[model samples]
Target chain A: MEIAKSLQQTPSSYIREILAAASDKNVISLAGGLPDEKTFPIDLMKPTLETLSEMPEVFQYGATAGYTPLLNFLTDYFQLPDTHIAMACTGSQQGLDLIARAYVNPGDKVVMEAPSYLGAMQVFGLVQADIVTVPQTEFGPDIEALRTVFYEQSPKMFYAVPDFHNPTGVCWSLETRKQVAALCEQYNVALIEDAPYRELRFSGEAIPLVSDFCPQHSIVLRSFSKIASPGLRVGIVSGKRSYLEPLIKIKQGADLHSSVPMQALLLGLLKHDNFDYHIDTIRTLYKSRYETLYSELQDKLPEGCEIKPVDGGMFVWVTLPSCDTFKLAKELLKDGVAVVPSPVFYPQPEAAKAALRLNFTNATPTELAEAVSRLASGLAKAI
Target chain B: MEIAKSLQQTPSSYIREILAAASDKNVISLAGGLPDEKTFPIDLMKPTLETLSEMPEVFQYGATAGYTPLLNFLTDYFQLPDTHIAMACTGSQQGLDLIARAYVNPGDKVVMEAPSYLGAMQVFGLVQADIVTVPQTEFGPDIEALRTVFYEQSPKMFYAVPDFHNPTGVCWSLETRKQVAALCEQYNVALIEDAPYRELRFSGEAIPLVSDFCPQHSIVLRSFSKIASPGLRVGIVSGKRSYLEPLIKIKQGADLHSSVPMQALLLGLLKHDNFDYHIDTIRTLYKSRYETLYSELQDKLPEGCEIKPVDGGMFVWVTLPSCDTFKLAKELLKDGVAVVPSPVFYPQPEAAKAALRLNFTNATPTELAEAVSRLASGLAKAI
Candidate 1:
């Protein structure tokens, strides 16, 4: 029948396509950014779930802002000022979605990194925003490109993954983070810093958050998906009241509130003394997987292919000379291995055809090596 | 700060305003449609939670379509056809919101029952849809009005709560249900039947769902919030594949999927033979509260005020002759009772000013009586 113009303009999730291709029982999936299920902290959560089940309020309707204790815990943990407001989201993706809803009008300009999180791009597209991309360099988004776009477009918001960006394992340099924040402030654009991978760092010193540089102009999204549990779908969006108040209002109609039992379970985990130890364990596990995948790709890939060095997060972005990653991805699937084509991440199609993203967190060390060898063979055929 | 045109046009949730006014603990709240916490199946869910906590898959990222077992269970429970597809939402509110996203373009016409669910109205407003209303008669939406709007406006969708409608507490006659389906099909408009209160019916025979009459042209939203647990936030939207597929695709960007552990716990409860018994207890509780409220209003209210007859569901719609319910509501609040003024539900403000909605399910029978006495006294002063 008649579909919304926004829905008509929006494309189905590219990640879902990759997921469908990787769903075969025999395939080794390095396409999805899923955390290792073996490290889900089930034993730790059993007692927490038991305690939560006894509380009737845990299963009753809760405040749309979120479970109070969890919000308090996040505010305290982040050391946010009293002027800042924090709300729980079903996931960080929802946090991004709400921000887009609160600020981006149809045909409004939204500036984002070229190879950014596909989910965020999908959200902007769904709202029918005119997305302008700034090419991302090794350290972060190209500051000059951002400045030029900001001056030319006066975009409504700038969305970035400052810490260990999705699809590309690139972390912003501390100077670049501050500069990006300063430029957004200069242009009066709201900044959305997506930090889902902040805690997954294996090496390199931590960069200060973009919000830390411009709290008044930035909204930071944090998630428990990588470190705690994804299935629970818990995340947070913290920002100044002017911006956050509208997002909270929109959130009420979005889902009323995130699930209360889910929030209580997260609150329980955050209250536990050994929560940091659990995060450390996760970091150690992913660090090993990252090393295995990176080294195997370097040793196995054909000559014209290049893998970027990554300090943290689930994915590694690889560039292949004279290759269409979408075609190569399909060819690789025939070899029983799956990786995401980079075109999904780019707003412009032409810039995305030569690169592919490989997630290192879901597969084992041995599986990573085998998947890479298979990918190399597939690449040879495609080239 | 540049805000979206849609958000600029949308008003904040009216329930939030009522909630803010009722935040004072001294006020007896008959305003919110919250389920009684005592009726929540806490003990029934304990064993379920224990089993879910032990399973790592419950905490891992789940299928965007939903947890398979839960989907299968719902399909069988509803006796849905093979051509129908079902997906889990964080809550049925989300199901409504996604439906709006999938179909209602900015400036597109939407036909809905007058004084419909405020939450649904807010969603359509957020998407900038042009909402056209059809007035409610004693039996259902005035079919003549609906037909006129359908032919004149050709609205994208018709949103209705056919069974024990919200705000009005009126169920459509079987003839009306079939008429709604036929009219929608005739005009090529999709029907969204929100059935959150279906299982909470305490009296009267259940009318067949609208989808039963026109399977391909209708989508049904069902929730566990009222009958099971609102805190768990579980719900489903089932419809023909064409409509459902787009909703699922949009759902991926709207929180990915409903929480898996929450769905698993629901599945566990469904598997238990006594699940219907839990729902029966909820119905019995509400039935008592509704009777207490209706009887008290009839005894205490001034001659000009009238309470509609309600067979089941949580609310009773009260119409006051030549008076502002908003002013009456404020006076009642001063007397320590809270109710939702009806203007929030109506698309046209003037139409809503003479009515108010009282929720019968949240407070005890004694509390309901006390609240009604206070409301009647306040009305006496206002008139």
Candidate 2:
């Protein structure tokens, strides 16, 4: 059977291709947005794992929304108002898919930062959404450009990652958060606030989620994959009941519901006394790795190449002097390092500036240093 | 926010509404197609659950295809051809959903029996497939009608449940299976064989899957939800590598694969020494419940009400004298029994015959008898 027209339009993920190549034993991969396997809070989850056999009900089919205990807990955990609710999904990735499926009609305009979460772009692309882009500033999205898009295009939704963003690690400033939220409210476009890296903040205090300023006009996709375990494939989506009900309905057909055992396990871990401390440890560990990658890049990158320090999250973005990044990435891989070229993060790859996204959370300080040496030497020759 | 136009065409699941009402303690519900909670082999799964913490690899991000060990085991266990492969999904439900999303474009002709799986209709509806239906018979689909549809419409695929089919529990006769396979091959139509209840046979010898006859032209969906635990949400889709890759691509955006821990847990349960015996016990238990409901309906059902005995699977369909099944179902609920009305099962509700799908698995023999009592009296009043 021929694949759907929609699937044909979706570019196979470049990161997946590079990651496949990066698996060579000699290569040190900073190409993937993988949380270090060692950082998984397996010990914190052990008590729940052992107790699951006793909870036979979890092994039965679950409510389409989620397991009740988890949903109830999340409503309070996220401080959702009576009008709002929470739904558990296979992952926040699925939550994003649901949003696109539920709300994005073909040709509907969906706004996003030019370099944004690739998975988000994938989902919206599958629905054949007309994805419009705005530039990202150090603070957040280029707010003036955003206003012009909203005013002219009148997009259905503006998708954003306000916490330590994937690829860029740019946390939206509080002022930017409020401004984006206000613009959303004014334009009546739904705000899809994706915060997969919220708890990974290492050096900076947390800023309010952009959704907080316009809760009535926003939906929040929160993930435990970073602080908890992605292998469990559990995440939470929250918004006003009216906003979330469509997603819940779509979810019923998406996967029935997420794994109940995973949900129950997540609830147990959340209730554990040391779960908060577990997040702290992930932050400290990732912070150290980020520092190692940052300092190494700063020292070795050729003049005119630039690097930015991140307060938290998995990646450091390096702005290279204009060059063919795909070729550079391939050459760097031959030198025993793997990184994602910036074009893969853009909806229109040709519009992307010369840059590379290097992940810090999945490697050690020594490995990070070696990868940078390979990257710098490779880049110096290319530039 | 208004839902997308695609979602707008999809009907809200009437089953959900009836299931919610069935939750009343006073109601003996046969409305849901739930396996008995007692059937879950939690004890058999315990050893794996307890040891999951020791397997840190299962707690990290896994391949989008599935957990490696589980995939390898299933590929071997199913005895798939060298060119065939297995990929795990959130459930067979997701397997169906992915097939629709990956292969069916809006207005693509997809074939199914008139009264078919609601979830299949749901996923297909979400993708705007132009569903074409053939009438079903005691043997399987009406062979003449199926042939006419396939030869004339040339649907992209024929979606079927060849064993102990849902709603009707009409396990196809061997001849019918072969005939359907021949028609699919002749028409060059893809066969989507969904076999969630294939293993639940208790009274008759098992028949070969329709896919066995049309292996090169089919994709098979196998579910453990009935034989194992639905809460784990693990199911397998297998076909030639070319046929399965598109689904794996769409699946990356769907949920980035099913939960890895759930996949691991399913793998352990499948490998347990007593797993086959556990299935035997479920078969025996459901057989007894089916007998009780079948006999009670035979003795007490109103004149003109017709019932069929099922050898396996969860439900028995009762065709009634021409009347409104929705009204009959509502009256039965008030009489303290809950059953799914036949109309709810159809893509076009008005085309459904007046019938009720009574589940025998979740309720006990005693409860099944009582539910039939309520159903009989309510039917007598309605007719």
Candidate 3:
């Protein structure tokens, strides 16, 4: 049977293919946006995992939205307004898929930074949305270009990762946050704020979410994978009840509900006394790795290669002289360093500039140094 | 913001509303298709739960298809052909949703029996599929009518639950299964075999799956929810690689994958030496409860109300003399026995026959007898 027209339009994921290639023992992979396996707070979660057998109710079917105890806790944990609510998903990726299915129509325009999260692009692409992009500046998406697109295209939504953005690790400045929120409210575009790396900050103090400025006009997606465990496959989506109810309706057909045991386990970990400290440990570990990679690159990168220091989050963006970054990445992979090329992150690959996203969280300091030596050698040969 | 046009056309699930109301302590609910909580094999899963912390790799991100070990285990467990492969989903429900998203385009014809699974209807509805229905008879679907529909409608697929079918506990006769498979092959309509209740049988000898006759032209959804636990939210979908590749693409955006820890736990339970004994225990327990409900209804249902004997499955359908079933269900709810009305199951509600679906699982034999007493008194007053 032929596949759906909508699905036919979505190119199969390139990251999945590259990740598979990078998994060979011969390569050191910084290609995936994965939290380190060692960072998972299993000791903090042990009490809940053991307690699950005693709580038989969680093993039964649960409410379509989420487990009540988790939902109630998140409402307070996030300090949600009276009109707002929280729903759990298998992961924040599913939350984005739900938002796309619930709100987007074929040909509906969706705005995103040019170099955006690959997973978000895939979700919106599956719905056949007309994805529009604005160039990214170090602060975030180019604000002027964003305003012009919103003013002219009247897009349905703007999807963004404001706190330590993926691919570039460019957190939106506070002024830009308020401005983007205001623009969304003015344009009647829903702001989808994905903060999977929000808690991974190592150097800078935290800032307010863009959604904080316009709560009614935005939805926030939170991930615990960085702090807890990705294998639990649980994430939270919060917004006003009106915005979330349709997601719940779609979710009923999606999975009935996410795993109740996972949700309950999440709630238990969030309530644990050591949970806050666990986040700090992940931050310090990632920070040390990030600094090691940064200093190594600063010492070794060739002429015309520029690298930006990230305050928090998994990756650092390296800008190279215009060249075939894909070719560069292929050579680098054979050189035994795995980094994602810039084009894969762009909705229109041809429109992307020459750059690469290198992750720091998954590799050890010594491996980070070795990978940079391979990266620098490959770049010198290409440029 | 307006919901997507497709979502707007889909009705909110009435089953969900009814199930919520049925949760009242005063109501003896026959509205939900829930397995008894006592059936969950927690003891069998305990050893695995304690071992999860040691296996740090399972806590990391997994392949989108599933955890490798679970997929390999299911491949042999299901005795799938060398050409076939298995993938995990949050539930069989998500697998169905993925199939619709991957295969059905807007306005594409999809076929089902008149009274079908509500979740299936919702998934198809979300895709804006043109759902065409054929009538169902005691043996399964009306074979002649199915052939006519297949020839005329040219539906992309026929979604079915051939064994101990939902709402009406009518297991398809072996002859009907063969006929349906032949017609599907002849007409080139893909057969989607959903077998959540296939293992719940208590008395009858096992029958070959409808898919077995048309493996190349079918996708099979097998649920562990009824046998292990629904809260795990893990199910298996198996078919040829070509048939399953599109679903994996859609599933990449759905949840990346289902909960890895849950999948691991399920594998452990399935491997346990006593797992088969646990299923036999559930079968025996449910069979006893089914006997009580069947006998009570057989003895006490008002005149003109016809109750069919079910070989197995969760529900028993009661055909009533022409009347308002929605109103009848409401009265039964007030009478302290909650049962689902028939119209909710129909794509074209007005065309449905007056009937009620009474569940035989979840409630005890004593409660089932009392529920029947209440149902009989209420029917007498109404009819």
Candidate 4:
């Protein structure tokens, strides 16, 4: 059968193959971007679940925009500007997909960081966007390079993770965030600020959102997947009404609306007085895990290998001196450790073949220590 | 800001405007495809809710393919062939959207019933497919026209709701179903069999699925939205592994996966011995409601109006000889009744301007009677 040209262009088998290998019972999987399930607010959710069980409306269809209470609560919680509108999504992933569908025509140019979120890359690619990458310089997308891509390609959209970016765990510098906003505005490009990890700060002060800098041109994507519960699949996309109106319509055709019970559960949690306390608990747990993974990698990785310090979020990215991370990832499966090779994150795989991403949040500290030792053993063989 | 050409092509304001009017407190809505909230299996779900409350895995990230247990259960329940694979979707709407993304390339010809599910049309439009619609006869799409479209346009895909099709309440004759399957195979076109309402049959013998006739080239979409709980947002798409493999990859970028807790709830219900009994109860209730609507419309509608006898599903489609349903829908809103104008269902609105769809399942018999009276009054004004 003939498949869509867009589907044909996606990186279909590589990630699935790695994920399949990671699923082996003997392997310690540090590859998946999953939050630690132990930190999920089971106790806190009991009341909400009980209340929802009695409410049949929780099991009925919701407005395509979202459950109204959740929409209102998120709007207030985020302190969205007067010009903005918020719509709930099945997940932030759906939010990204909707944005791509609403704004990206086939072959439209979409700019991104050198190693961006593979999920977003897949969505853009499925829409048949011409994905152009700007290098990341420890902080975020290289702003100067972003300017050049904007002028050269006149891309329709620029997607960035402003805080605790996936795979790399690098937050944008405040100045870079401002420059990105300005560049998008100057080039008349839409800025997609994906902030799934924005609330996951373990160190450094909070940075102003890219949407704050370019409220009119930026659409900020947020999710409960990291701090609340990934399995519930609740998230939101907030932006100027003009952009959001199209997304809302596209979302109607996407899934009609998000799961109403999940939306109600989230609404109940958000409305609770102790919601912030629950988030604080999650932050403390992830922070400790991050520290454990950082120290273990520092002690175990080969000399000349580089590890970037993470301020927050689940992953720790490492750059090997001379290794093929994809090949190493496969070899490490035999050594009983699994990490995501960095090529999956890049629009062009050959551009970054030596880095790998380790997810520290899902594994225990003891497992992290053991996993790092196994990774080191595999790296030794590869180098 | 510039939007995608596809989004621009969609019917953005028309449906929303009607929905906004329907939402007024004074309006009695026969417009929405909502199942009655009172019929939701809250009592039956108590055990499942209790079980899920204790399972932390319910709140953790699920496999991108789906929760494994649900996937296995659905595959078995559907009695899919060994060559097939099943993947969970947020809902069947997402299933449709994914099929379009995986198969319908830009300007690729897609054939559908003239008055089909507007949701499917929107998804196909968002992908910029050339939508060539076949006219719907009472028994389904006109087989002769479908064959002509197949031979002439050589469409990439053919989307059909084989049983109790939306907005039309038409089930395909057994021969029609077989012919649709054979034609799709002969033309080398993928067939999307959306069967959300297949199980809601209150009359007539069960018709074998289109996939039953042509399993290799057909993908069948099933949803719990009609039979179980719409709010939970769980559905499955099953087809040959060759076709499903691409959809599974596209689903990875769609929303990662459906909500895990929702999947578990559905799994629990499907496993219970009383599951079929619960569906029987829904069928009985909807059948009575459908009868109520049919009778009330017969008593109230003007001379020269036509109504199809629904065998199952929530809708009763009406055709008026001298009235425009869109204008009548607006005028009826003033009399406190709301109905979905059928033009939205047609690819070309001018072709079906005199018909409308009324949802019988959500409203009570008394409300259905009252809505018909109000509709009659509005029709009087239009005539």
Candidate 5:
């Protein structure tokens, strides 16, 4: 069978396959950046199911912009006008795909953060865009490098995870975000600020989106997958009317709309008194697990190894000196533990082969400790 | 604001806007091709939602293919082997979009039925494909015309809704389907068999999909949105392993996956004894309403006006004599009646202006009568 030439060249998601293989076991899997299912407000959702069942059309076809009530809820929650918001399914990945479709023509230039979410990189690749990854410093991306890249590529958009950045878990500082926003404004480039983990702040005050600087040019994406239920496949896109209206049109062509029942249920949960209370509880739960894993890695890992403790979100990023982390990850999986190989997160695979992302949210405290111990042992053996 | 250049050309869904505008007390909208909400198994979904709430992780990020249980249920229901299945959100529109992304290169040659589903045409158009629509005869698309077009264009794919086709509400005869399938096989052309209205058979024996003739080269899409709840956003795609695999990859990039809670709830509903009973109940309900519509139009419509009494599905495709449907539709809107101008369904906008699509599913029998009377009055006055 002659497959699509593009698909023939496309690589299947390695993380997706490994996650599926580990699902049936007690594999201490930290590979997938999934929120702990124990924290998803199922009790609140239980009543929500019943409430939405009363209006069956709520379980039927909805506007492509997503369910109106949920969009309204998100607009109010994000402090954006109703015109600035549109919702999507599949966490923030669908939002990324929409951005790719609406903005990037073939061979168009796009700038992304080094070690950003693997899925976003894949989206850029699928659109056949020329992607330049600007290196991130301790707090955020290097602004000077961005300026050089902008001059070289004349990129149309910069895709960034400003809050609790994926794979690396570094949030942009308020000043850095403003700086980048100003640069984008200077270059007239769009900023795709993905903040799927914005609300899971275990520490630090929440910063307003980069959209604050140039509302018309900045597109911000937030997802329920981290704070609530990823299985619901709900995410919100907020930007100025100029960017959002085009996105809504692209969304209609893409999926007609997101799931109506899921949006209705999410709206019900949001309206419930216990919604914020449950998110607070989840924050505390993940905070302890993250702290436990961070300490374990710091103590057990080799002296030259570095670990970045995430302020929020599910992951803890680790870098090892002179070790094949991907090989070590496979060895750890053999020991019934799994950590995502960080090479998958990069535009060029060889650049990030020595790093790994360990998710602390889904595992229990003991499991998190045991998983890190296994990784430590595997790293020692591999080195 | 410098918007992405790609969006500058992508046409907005004209039908979707009309659907939104018609949501009022006076508007009798026939614009949306929606399955009747009253006929859906809404009550049965109550327990399914309750059961889903118990599994919190079901609300978390799901497998890229879809929820496993739903996939398994759909596989068994469709009687297809595991190798040939994929799941999509909302309906098969997403499936079509994913297929377009995976297979279509810019400026590719594609083929379509003369007046196929506008949504599918919208997708092909977005990919910048040159589409040739074979004229539809009473039986189906003209077989000889298809052969000529297929040979001339050597299209990337032939998109057709053979099972109770959309807009026209015409099902291709099994003989025509086989002839088309055999021709596709001979020419090495891929076929997309979109069959949302398959089980909505008002009469006549069910025809097995054309894919059964050339499964290796065809993608068959079915949806629960028509027979069940569109709000859940569940649909099934089945074809050769070679075709399905690429579609699955596209699915991964498109939305990670559909909602797990919705998928699980749907799987639970499929397990019930009342599942087929509910489908039959829908068939009976729609059949009666369709008859009422056909009789009313026949009685009230002016001489020389043509209306097709469809065997299945939710719409009645009408072609008025010597009247501009675009203008008449606006006039009808003023008189509290609405219909979609059928020219929008055609690939070439200049092909027809006298046709319109009236939906029978959403309106009640009494409401249908009033709507049709208004349509008659609108037509009589306009013509």
Candidate 6:
């Protein structure tokens, strides 16, 4: 039977495919953007689950927006006005789906940064949005390129990972964020700020949300998948309540609500003083992992291959010298190393290629050093 | 900001809106179709959570198709032949949304039972499908009416809650299900069987699924929100591998996966020897609740009102004599009683005006009797 035309339009996510294909018993994967399992707050989670179990409401269907306490905590955490937060089931990916369903119409233009989060691109493609990829400089999305795309496409919305972006672990500069916000206001484009990695910053001070820059037109999304636990599938969206109203309605029709027990656990965690302490520990762990991976790549990778330090977040983006990342990745998988090619990050094939996203978060420091060494040796032979 | 015209076309769910409005502290809620909290299988669930917590994989990002063991259990439970099953987050509501997004293109013709599940109606409406409701009879959907709709609309699919139907509380006789399956096969239409309440049957042997009759063209959905735990948000969709393939793709883009921890807990419960014993206990309890509700309604309902016994499910479908149930519900709520107007059950307005769905499962026998008594007295005074 023919699948729906809309799904036919959505290319299966390459990261998912590559990850699945690389599931060999031998492969050490840096391909998937998975948070290191060790970073999960197991000690705290054990106690939190005990507390959640005591509250029977935690195991029942919750409010469509979120579990009441989680929403309240998020509102306070984001320091948004009261009642401006909503929780989502799964990752922030569900947030993307809800936003697209709530606001986007078929054939509407959607401006996204080139080499963006593959999942967001997949969601936009499913919505049948005409995708326009704005160029990206090392600092984040290129402000001038964003302006051109906004002017040319007059897009309904612009999607970005302003804080420690996916695939390329570069946060948008504070000035660039204001410029983009100003352009969005000028062009009447809605801004979808996905900040899943916002809390993972190791050294940088927090940048004020673009929602502060463009309050009416912005929605900022956050997820526990990064710092807390992805297994619980809890995410939050905060913004102007006006923009959130439609999203709530969409969420109501999607799932009655996110899991109440998960939300309760998250709420319990957020309420504790240790939440900040946990995030700090995670930041330090990720930073050490990043250093180990970066050093190993520097030592082992052949000349002409280049790597850059990630300001924050779990990934280290690498560009191999004149090599097909996908083919090299496949060959490396045979030799027990797996990495996601960079081309899959773009909305369309015509954009660019020749890089790979290596996640340092999921691997141990020793494993990271070994994987990078193995990948370099594999690439040398394959090239 | 104006929501997209597409979302505009989808009507807000009548059940959700009424339930939200019925949140007044004084109002007795017969409005929501929620199951009794007392039957939450807390004993079983405690063990499930303990087992799940011990499993390290429970706190990780799972495969999009869902936890493998749960899928295996569901495939066995559904008695499908080599079918693929995927888990949905929150509840079966997300499953419906996935199906809508995966298949129902704009203006696609859909055939649904009149007075259908309001949640399904709302999702289909959002997909912009041309919805045509087939009249529901006491035995099942009106077969002749369905044939007529099929002839007229050439619908892409038919949606039904055959066993212990929603709002109406009527089960399609086995013969009727067989006939509907034949017709769907003849017309080349897919059948979406929503069986959240199937296992909740108070009496009678379980009817074989619509998929048993037409596996190739059927999708059978099940939910733990009803039997296991709503707050944990676990649901499954099982069908031929062919269709399930696309649905999995849709779900992947939608939520990535259901909560791994929740799935692990559910799988543990299902594997435990006490699982069936727990179901038996719930069934016995709900049976008593149903009897109490039926007897109370008979004793207290206004003269011309009728209440019928439902073989299974959480609801008692009541038809009031010549009174508008919506207005009567409001009057009853003022008297500290609440009921959902039956009109919301229908895909369109007219079918629901004179009826209301009273949930017998969610409340204790004493509470059910008292609510019914209040409703009877309020009905006498209102009309």
Local accuracy by lDDT, each model: 0.87, 0.92, 0.93, 0.87, 0.81, 0.80
For each candidate in turn, the interface RMSD (Å) is 1.0, 0.7, 0.6, 1.1, 2.0, 1.5
CAPRI band for model 5:
medium
Candidate 5 local lDDT, A37-142, one digit each (tens): 7787888888877776788778668877878878777777778855576665546778888888787876788999888888887788787788888999877999
**Least accurate stretch of 10 residues (summed lDDT) in model 5 chain B?**
B1-10
lDDT for model 2 comes to 0.92
Every model's TM-score on chain B: 0.98, 0.99, 0.99, 0.97, 0.96, 0.95
Select the stronger candidate by lDDT from 1 and 6: 1
Model 1 Cα displacement at B289 (Å)? 1.5
Every candidate's DockQ is 0.82, 0.90, 0.91, 0.79, 0.66, 0.67
Give the C-alpha lDDT of model 4. Answer: 0.87
Ranking by DockQ: 3, 2, 1, 4, 6, 5
lDDT tens digits, residue span A1-383, model 3:
99999998998777777788899898999898888888888998899999899999999999889999999999999999999999999999899999999999999999999899999999999999999999888888899999999999999999999888889999889989989999999988999999999999898778999999999999999998888989999999999999999999999889999999999989999999999999989999999999999999999999999988899999999999999988888888899989999999999999999999999999999899999999989899999
Reference-based lDDT, residue A145, model 5? 97
TM-score of each: 0.98, 0.99, 0.99, 0.96, 0.96, 0.96
Question: All candidates: CA RMSD in angstroms?
Answer: 1.4, 0.8, 0.8, 1.9, 2.1, 2.1
Show pairs that collide, candidate 1. none
Clashing pairs in 2: none
Query: Is candidate 1 or 4 superior in DockQ?
Result: 1
lDDT of 4 by residue, B190-215 (tens): 88899999899999898799889989
lDDT by residue (B1-383, candidate 1, tens digit) is 76778888886566677778887888899898889889888778888888876688878889888999999999999999999989999899999999998887778888888889988988999988899998999889999999999998888889999888888899888999889889988998988999988887888887799879988899999998987898888889999999988888788887888799999998988888788888888888888888899899989999888877877888899888877777777888889999988888987768664888899888888888889888888888888
- TM-score, predicted candidate 1 vs. hidden true structure: 0.98
Model 4 over residues A53-166: C-alpha lDDT tens digits?
A: 788887888888899888898889999989998999989999999998888877889998888898998899888898999999887888889899999888888998879888
Q: What TM-score does candidate 3 reach? A: 0.99
Model 1 misplaced stretches (Cα beyond 4 Å): none
